[model samples]
Target: MAKWTTENPAFVDTWFSLFRLGQTKKQFNAADTIKMSELTFFNPLSSKDNLKIEATLIADTIDKVFSSWGAKLENSISRNTAINDMIQILLDEDKTIKDLAEKNDENYFFTNEIKLENES
Candidate 1:
């Protein structure tokens, strides 16, 4: 994606909001995907447009990652730029996770459900 700029003010605003939502939510659902679909340049579900496809992927990812894990900062850029930055961040995170998995067994990070002992 091209660098995000202020030229697309609407996209910028929407992304900013989605980014913030990631911080407060434990997980996003299909409803969130529908909401972010509003950012698409065309009808994402029905249209085969490239912009629409990109928009759908972005929305799906936002929902999947819970809004960039609330890592959005006050950076000035256009929609494309924002997308680029987000992809970069996610890639970086993936790399770290992969490294950790390689260091330990595949289930290294997968543990059983948390158990809380009685405080009383």
Candidate 2:
């Protein structure tokens, strides 16, 4: 079977998630994945559109890692800028999106059991 692609994006519940972090080692660790998965900052179920991501960019959020990405999907320019700005986060020795999300989330959104896809 083919892997999931952006053209046919997967819709995920805000309560649980499994996403890969860039530049990070994919070696699974139970506690670390839990911390990353629990972050409300990256929750895909946002009702917010044209989001100003900076307000949420504090201690434990993806925006903190890419502070230049202040605007959201407002326009092609903004989208391109934000996407380009994201490249900075991949720089070595810089704090990562994984670092911020794993620090602690506000937990304002959903909270429920998150299990590995392989689990029965």
Which RMSD values do the candidates have, in order? 15.6, 15.7
lDDT tens digits, residue span 28-118, model 2:
3332323323433434454343122522232223333233322123223343343334323222123333432322122211122122223
Q: List candidate 2 segments past 4 Å from native.
A: 1-77, 99-120
lDDT of 1 by residue, 24-51 (tens): 1312222222322232232434534554
Q: How many backbone clashes does candidate 1 have?
A: 6
For candidate 2, which ten residues in a row score worst on lDDT? 7-16
Colliding pairs, model 2: none
For candidate 2, the per-residue lDDT at 84 reads 35
TM-score of each: 0.22, 0.24
Best by lDDT: 1
Task: Return the clash pairs for model 1, or none.
Answer: 3-81, 4-77, 4-78, 4-81, 5-77, 5-78
